[model samples]
Target: MAFTGFGGSTSGTTDFTQELVSATGLAERDRPADLRVWPNPTPDGTFTIDAGEARILGLEVLDASGRLVRSLGALSAAPFTMELGGLGAGSYTVRLLTDRGPAVARLLRQ
Candidate 1:
């Protein structure tokens, strides 16, 4: 995430607190990992999964308490999108079962 600020007409200062906070948060989340997921805290009933060069065998959505909510088998492509229409508002775990290993990510429903 990028932010721009307009210069002041006179001598002034720019508060870096907000920018620092935002940058830290973004950096912590957007790591160069093998897998990625997005649209977390989404209400659109959809989310994406990015499995880099891994053969995805299955996908599972688990509730916050570690209960299995849904399972999908045999994904044929990378960066696949899944629908979460029936899921209620809460935190969830999206597990991508690949041939190499399981890539886990967090998801939030709104």
Candidate 2:
């Protein structure tokens, strides 16, 4: 599967959804080379993403079924706090775009 950049869809909703699902699935499959996420199953309110030596450009949170829940823009440092209070109780994926590569972590809401 190919990686698709983040954007809205003007095409058919079904096609767009499929493409997004495929792209996000592919991204989750390939782990980042240098980033890390602490407290594996994250607490419901906040969490951190550590980029190690890499620079984190942004972060995206996805629901269990691969739906985009939130996009965190332009992190200023290696470890950044993300608010998860509005998220529903379930499993979520946190994807980080770093200087090294993309990093993905599974977050659990309690």
Cα lDDT of all candidates, in order?
0.78, 0.73
1-110 per-residue lDDT for model 2 (tens digits)? 54454455678443322233453554552545465666666655577778776777888999999999999777886677778777778888888887667778888876
Candidate 2 regions with alpha-carbon error over 4 angstroms? 1-31
Q: How many collisions between residues are there in candidate 1?
A: 0
Candidate of highest lDDT: 1
* Model 1 lDDT per residue over 2-100, tens place: 444444445575443223346455454344336788887788768888888787898899998999999999889778988888778999998877766
lDDT for 28 in candidate 1 is 40
**lDDT of model 1 at residue 29?**
39
Q: Which 10-residue window in model 1 sums to the lowest lDDT?
A: 14-23
Q: Against the true structure, whose TM-score is highest?
A: 1
